[model samples]
Target chain A: MNKKWMSITVSLVLVFTLLATACSNKEKNSGGSTAKEGGKGEQVTITHYTIDSPDRTFVEKLIPDFEAKHPNIKVKVTKAPYEQFDSKLQSSIAAKNAPDVTSHWGYGGFMEYYNKEMLLDLTPYLDGFSGSDYNIPEDVMNIYKVDGKTYGIPLNSYVTVMLYNKDLFDKAGLSYPPTDYEDKSWTFDKMVEYAQKMTVDSKNLEEAQYGVDFGFGERDQRPQYFGAHVYSDDTWSNGGKPSEINLTKLEVVDAYKTIYGLIYDKKISPTPAFSQTVSGQYGDPFLSGKIGMSVVGSWSLAAAADFSFNVGVAAVPYNPNGDVRSVLYVDPLFVLKDSKHPKEAMEWIKYLITTEIQEKSIELSGGNPPVNQAAAEKYYNNFEGIEPKGIQQVFDGAYKYGFESYNHLISNYSQINELFINELAGVENGDKQVENVLPDIEKKLKDLLARVNK
Target chain B: MREAALKESANEVRRMRKWKLSQIIGFVILLLVTITMLSPVWFMVTTSLKTTKEMLVFPPTLIPKVFAWGNFSELFTNTDIKFGQQYRNSLIVSIFTVIGTIISSSFVAFGFARYQARSSSFLFMLVLSTLMLPYPAIMIPQFLLFMNLGLHDSLLPLILPSFFGSAYMIFLLKQFFSTLPDELYNAGRIDGCSEFRLYWNLTLPLAGPALATVAIFSFIWSWNDLLTPVLYLDSQENFTLPVGMAAMLSSKFRLAPWNLLMAASILSVLPIMLLFAVAQKRFVEGIVLTGIK
Candidate 1:
């Protein structure tokens, strides 16, 4: 009898505990859904997932305004760190709870999402607004197009340029690199000459004041100067042989040799060793006043504006033979196919690209160069003190000369990048010649391509 | 005899000197290792107090020239990041996890330890095999299950899982329960005490160290867990500290504010450190008791 009573008591307690847990969970669900259905006539909450950054602040600031303007819609922004955003976004999509709109880069993962039919075809919405209303150039819009259908609206575009410290140039008694894109004198050889002069303690290279910091490995930037494409054909045809490894080409070899000279022969740039120690310690060697010049993206403008010394912006130095080409990084906003409110999401995206929002972005965040032409012009022309002179060149270079390499589109980019770096590591450390390693690297890359393509 | 005594004294002095020398060497080595281990923590604290400009300087300053204590204040006061609310959420989740894991795990462990069904060993092995299944393999399935149950976005997804005893914890507690004498249980049964009372009284009272061990592990695991919280919780008000700190480090437009990040990191780690310090004795005893028995 005692045992039976004890068993009954235990079962009752367990039942109550489970009931309590379930009730609490149900309460939370009801609470959230009720708020969504509250006062302003059936509010629709649109979730926006983006990276947590100062740019997020702009979104947060604009949400209230957006909500006030569109009384029925409430924008909920969830931000994760940049590193975790991709994985989280993938998991969320898999879980069938992806945000209505998301910020994505114009390359690799975006292409994957588009291929998977996860992203909405934004073409129908594009028809609502005229081309002139968007103000983004045709070529810029082409970046977000897959199979001749647009999937994303580019929020901003950034291009790499030679950012030099004018104070360093003056101290070195050298003329500034030309800002004009067509300047014949602003070639790779001329930049190298200037780098040599600007570099201090060329003999004791380890402790030397560097003339230029590429901000990344030489393989990424130096190849661009020589117009060395990673693939024989630069077109991206899905699952087709549009990609064939072309690392063994004479032009590509020459590009590698020139980069090798910059690191080992000229000693104008910091060695990989010096970079390992001081790169993060002194943020952006150019901004830290440690290097005379740096090849950096438009994102560096905010840091440049805060530099203690005067800064100068110029077109990236090109090879005399190669056409002027700057690497452009475009960030685009995409609406998910599973989004409950695609029309509303598109409206928000259109609002983001407007001149008013772009201008506010400039005032609040020292915004990225607006994709809208009028806004870009206003941003550069009205830009005041500390914005490095010749800010217009960034826009000019991007519009006229910007080219995104096949590297960004390739799924095996990190692997290919690793192959190049591993082969060049010996040359970078001054132990091997570029000529000796090029053929070996080309063989390995071809094998990798065959395997990856298979 | 006097000469012998003097010689013995000299030998004793020599031995003492040698002993002192070895002791000094050991102390020096230990001190060096401790310093090396503690340097990163020291750097984090100092870096938190540094200005953005100072943080970027090469061969980083061990001491900040301008101590920006405002980093802490800024972290607390940031409107976008509800640090206080997230801290509270973490505490709630961790507390429930600890209680649920202890109660459920001990209950399951007592059954496995005392019961003698025909397939008991096979069943035990089956429970143990779950430990081999990695979290990722079952993550999606578990997520779908929770979603079907309408528990997807709530803290219940994190909390309710703990109520079903974990394989590792159950294995640990079962081992601990087996070490106890059966006489206690038999004696309680003779006194007309039921199986439930016997477990509630005789076993649970004697399982203090084991329960403490389980509690500490559960608390720390739940507290530090990033993936589960990130998966389940979407709202900022419900976010855990790890996820919030990760968000702090990855900025899309501007450079990450390292000082504020470090300050938040330090604050997040403080609770775990305090918990460990408080329950350290029982934790160690539990491990030793389980290991030998």
Candidate 2:
């Protein structure tokens, strides 16, 4: 009787425990106000996931001001590192619990949400704000459209150009920079000639100073200089149209040989090791007047404002064939489809893209050249610094040289440069020919394309 | 002749002593190898003290040129990347996770060690096999299940899954428990100590070293995890330190202030390292104690 009673008590206890668990679960499920049911009432809290940390004093300042404007709504911003953002966004989207707004990297990542039919067709709201109101260019606006609708607003548009140290040019007794932006009568040959003239060999000869430096690290931007014209065949993929990567057809190989010549044949450019060591020395090597010229972004103008040397800017040099191109990449701001308060989200996004907001963001970030040409020109007129002069030159030059799309999806952009660095090193150190390196690289390029697409 | 032979033996002893001295030199080199392995962590700590401008310089400095104490203050003051809330959430998750691991794995391991069934060994192997399946393979399916269950965007998803007992932890505890004498359980049974009493009073108390080992491992794993918290937690108020640190490091334009990142990184590491130092004695004891039984 005692053993039987013990078993019965144990069974009773187990049943009671399970009942308690069920009751607790029911309470939890019913307790919280989830935004999915079109959250109502005053103090409607919305969650945002972004790569911006609240840890920055700047981010904290915006929250209280935003809350004060909409007393009934409180916006909470949550951030994680960029590396984790994609996976987190993916998982959150799958769960239908994603933040109301997210800062997307724009191209391939945005496609994932679009293909899943998880993104809202933001076109209906676009009419409320015009290109005039948002200060977004129609040309840039076209990049964000997909399948006859829009899902994002262009945040910051950037163009890549060459920033040169004018002090180094004056010291070498070279002519002053050309004032006319379109006149690249300053051809690739003149660039090489000036770079070589500016290079100095001290008395010891053990150490040498160079006139020009190019990035040769894991960054695929190094190869974007070559690949932009080579593998960019989007029109062919989308339609049956024969959109060709012009480099494979054109005599662009001659331009490639010339860049190789600048480093090896003329020895004017810094050695591979020198460029690697000084890679993001944005204002250092060139500003310190060691390197005469560098191919860098438009932001370099702002970075070099306080430097001791005078700065000059020019468009990327032209190939003798007249096919000159510079890359324009943008980071886009977007609202999630499931947001309960799409109107408020749209208002914030519209505010973020406005000329006033763009200038504020640029000021906060120190130098984002405005995507809105008129506003950028306005900013220039108001600005006191000598830095905006070069930035203004960059804006004028971009009209002729800039290409809208970039090769952000080139599979293993970082790894391709490893091969380029090796081959470039081989040419500089030995009796290797530049002509011999292209075939192997061409094959490697095809393989990378296959891997990424596969 | 006797004198000369004795002198020659003394010389041989001296030669052996010199050989031992060389071995000590080899051991010193081995100690240096261990220190070299630890140098990356040392560099991370020191680099966190450096100003953003100095951190990026070539031939990275071993020490800070200007140590900024404000980096720590900035970590708390600057942004919504709430280091305090994150630290609290991680502590809550890790504490509950450690407790769950000890309770569930001990029960599962006891059954494995004490039972005698034809399928027991097969089932044990099946559990061990789960450790080999990479997390990505099951990630999507598991995510959908939780979403349907309405567990997403909360700490429940992060914490509740740990209650079922991980196969890896169960296997580890089973290995330690298997080494325990069968005689102890049998004696308890004869004395009319219930199975629950045997486990609670006799088995668990004696398994302290193994329990300590499991607790420490579970705590570290949950504390350092970035992926799960990234996937489940959506609110800034709920973010873990790893997620916060990652956000601060992602920008391409205005370079992330490295000093603040470094200071936050130092804070993230301190508690875990302290736990490791405290639990290390138990870890060593567990390995030795588990083998003895």
Candidate 3:
């Protein structure tokens, strides 16, 4: 009896354990299958990964509409946080589980994705897509092309413009910066002169208020205004060949000295150390009204709305070469190379860039200028409410004289930029002069470019 | 003698006073350290309750003037976030991970503790060596293996790995099991207890503290895991809390809604906090017992 009982107990335990494992496995399988299934046979589910944004409401509202129209298709939108999205996307692609469609910034090593063959050449999709039906401009669409093959569709674009605090300008008794794109009076020298006048300091040289701030770092805008082409040629745009660093050029060196002087010599902008003390306490020095003006992107409009005093916009301070240029950034949506449902992804991208969707997205996002020229014009004109004075400058700056930022075209951009920034940090901090460090910066850039290109 | 006794008492009073002063100083330092350590958490709670305008105000406020309980309500009511679904997913994954880790690690630890084999030491060392291998080093191979198993986008990838036993957990359990008196096992065998029965009824019941430690650790680890879920789970519906919260915090075009993000963060951390609170006594006892033995 004892033997029989023991054996029975052991057998029962084994049976139960196996049963449990089997049940769990079955549950997992069922859960996976249910998630995979759309509704019926031949229903395609396209998963799109995108950065989380306040404008995400538009996408969320539109997905159901898209699903209703295409009964046989389902769209799953996954948003990764902006900071982690790039690394997350890379890991997902490495795992061979990349989303069908993803949002990408059109600059800053975007070609690395194309070069690695991770992006689907959407030229064929664009051909089938009634191109003329959408009001998206050729220039905007061309931004996403690599070697004559289109890979992405421009979803939204923004221009960097001068955001000046009107209250601060009044306190300094200075006239408002020119809002017109063609205003030659709004030159780099004029901006510096205004900054010098506005900067206030105590006897101890403790700045009570800074003259001006570049919400982006000085490296981003100064090089552009001075026409210091980092690349040898326009290879970044045309995709012809790799180019060498042009930091040794007189124009580049002069731009660096002028910007560095603003921080260390002129003491018009807050240093990195001073900025750290007030971190998280204010949105930005410019918005906080501690600075007279800031060269910032159109996205700053959202923050501008909340300012206690009035805010105004102007075209970025111009170069001496009789050209007014500002940095333009285009956020695009691309179809992944390994997507099983490329056609569906293309359809979604097409839907995103339509004039109606673009206009609505701009309206919903509260100032992301549309890529479609007509939609952009419509958005600018129909915009309601207490507009930030000279808001038209954003559109004018974009359409007339916007150029890609320095790092936008280079494949090894991050590495090269890091080296430049580290060298420039010394200049900014008064530890080294621009003339003294330019040689080292030039050498490091060349070595990095060579290594990366090789 | 009476005079000497009085003098000693006076000295004792002086000594006690000095000791009391030192203790007060130590207490103040500890209080400061504690506040410093906990300030970030306090900021998170307060920020969650502050309006966007208040958040961007110069010189941040410690206590919000108008508490925005609406942020929490918005988190729950937002259809797009699916916070409740993510919370459930996290709970399910964490519970399974705890059960699996306890069961698998205890089983393996028992073998290492009880058995005497020719290569037992070598095999045990081999298990310990796996602790040196970083998760990222083997992440690709493991991902590929799961992909091949058709478990790419499911919580199975997160849960199933716990069943195989972790080297660290096994090491901890082995250390614990080895401290058990061997005569109990010998006596059980003489009375006709099988090895499996010994493990199931006798040994496991006595291993309450160790098992509790393993359970709590597993639960916390699985609950806080962001990367594994982000890699495996593609859809938001299947996302765990950490992944969901991360998604909510990320925005490229504009700054994240900090108030809402903080509210979601508070919600995500509450479960682990509650678990720790409930298990605090046992958890401490487990660690103390493990250390002593």
Candidate 4:
């Protein structure tokens, strides 16, 4: 009887709790879909969707300024986590409730939307707007044009660079890697030498301090640094068509051997397991100060905001064959054609690239170089240890010799990368040699690429 | 005779010692299990209190060099995270789900078990077949249905379905209801109780343990459900704890703030822990009474 009474009491309590919440739920439900337009001069809420990035929070800070400038527009922003961003964006667009403005991952995403006719041609929205004010070069803007229709505006430029822990280099008594992109003295071998000196290996991986992490430079982007072209440059210019792949090249094979030897033979770099073990609980190993030099994209510069070590950004080391190549990535701002307020979305995107916003991006986004060459020249001044001249050289070398990365411009890139990574996993795991694995993947890679491109 | 009595006394003492030894061994074994079970919980609590820098060091410090009490404090004050709002959202959704599941599942189970018909058994089997359908198979059509009704990006989609009864809960409950003797209802009928009154007054009160078991399961499922909210919710203000926490540590372009995530996680799980602690006895009885493996 006591148990029965207790059960009845619990059920009664749950009923009361439900009643209380139902009332509040009614209040929230009544205020649903706040995006409706009001009077001629009344508030119009425009939804902006963005992914988690160094720029995410920085953009959040600037949103208030944007809202302040346009009193009639209330900008409601939703930031998806990095992994969920694509799925969320696709779903939102499919539901015909696409955000007014969003950060397009790269050229490929913009082109994908273009082929689907999902993008709003911002060319009409630009009208008399001068691209120069925001450091948007006409040539760069023209790069996004398809038959005289412009769908995207350059958000920022992310160039691959070597981010070294200056404190670790000093402790190891090695001179810092040159920030001068033109320096002939810095090479892959020189980097490995410096790396070997700093590496302190232990049977217990958690205690080991790695000398370097190539940060996917050792993956598909391998050919980029080695001056080997696997795909035709015309792929993007031809509306993201299938590109014939040629990975049997001597340079391509050598690039794989070089990166893998660093992991297996030299053992100076962290293996895949090392990174996962450390990164699962801790953040990035480089930020943990366990890594000496991490050759990665410029976006990693955002680590300086919280990183304890003195960090510096330098140009990538040249290949032993006297070739130099830096991978360049450009994030674009795209508004959907289905957006309720296209004009308002344009205003918000334009605000993201202003001199003030771009400059603050360095502080907030950590390392996003404003496409404005002048701003890019002064990008490193925002950080404590990074010198202005050195950072300028990093940008200069990129513009001089670097090509736009093919991943963002090609169709079925993420899929191609995934398949490539799966094939390359054994090499990284010390099971297979690059010479053996690279040959086998060429057909599989081409097939996957063709399947998606078609 | 005195010597014989002494031998018997010695035998009794040895027997007592052997019993005491087994008890000691049992205690040690249980202690080992307890420590093993609590290890991850200990790690979470410690990690929450450590600074991000300290947490990242290799061969990670078992004891933090610096105890960052600020991690928990930051969860409340950070403008980016609306912890209070999300907590309220989770609580409301979970509680309502429990109430709805308990009432609806029991009602359906009663009808299936008590009222017999030519097709009643077949219908129960049909209901059980729904348990085999994977959620992803139905996710799209359901999403489309909810979206058309303008319930997308709202709590309604998360709470409304609970009122219809879950197939798994219904099945567990049907089996439980079948065990109740028919004579109870027959006896109540003889005492002038209506069919509804028998269901309401007699069966429901006796169905306490089974109902409690279902309520607990529904509450936990709703509380920890990330997919429902992640799919349905758009605004941060509408997010529940699971979705909000996932957003914070979502390893995308941004690095996860592990310390803050741990702190929020510890705080987020307290209610579930408390619920279990408060209702543990009845919950165990629920499982035992239902004879569910």
Best by lDDT: 4
Best by DockQ: 1
lDDT (10s digit) by residue, model 4, range A213-315: 8874325666767666566657757876656666788878877777788888898988777777777643466876879998777767755656767888887
Backbone clash pairs for candidate 3 read A81-B250, A82-B250
Candidate 1 has what TM-score?
0.88
- Candidate 3: stretches off by over 4 Å: A1-43, A67-73, A91-96, A105-108, A128-133, A197-208, A215-222, A237-241, A248-250, A280-289, A306-309, A321-324, A381-389, A406-408, A412-447, B288-293
Tell me the tens digit of each residue's lDDT in model 3 across A339-362.
Answer: 888887888788787888787777
- Cα RMSD to the true fold for all candidates: 4.5, 6.7, 4.8, 4.0
lDDT of 2 by residue, A1-454 (tens): 5467457556744653563355235422211123333345545556656665322223334667567777665566655566666676676666555667665542234444554455666788776666656667786776656756777777767776676777778888998545345666876677777888888744332245677765321232333444334445573234112133333443445545656677777878865555545444222355335678876555455555544457676666654454434566655666777776676666666655666656665565566666665567654543334555755676666655555433332333334445555655676554577567666666665665455434
DockQ of each: 0.41, 0.37, 0.36, 0.32
Please write out the lDDT profile of model 1 over residues A287-351, one tens digit for every residue.
45668888877677766545656888877876666664577777778899888778788878888
lDDT (10s digit) by residue, model 1, range B216-264? 8899899988878777766667788877887776553456678888888
Best-to-worst ranking by TM-score = 4, 1, 3, 2
TM-score of chain B of each: 0.95, 0.87, 0.93, 0.95
Question: Model 1 in CAPRI terms: which quality?
Answer: acceptable
Cα RMSD for predicted model 4: 4.0
Tell me candidate 4's TM-score on chain B.
0.95
Q: B204, model 3: CA deviation in Å?
A: 2.8
lDDT of 1: 0.74
C-alpha lDDT score of every prediction, in listed order = 0.74, 0.63, 0.72, 0.75
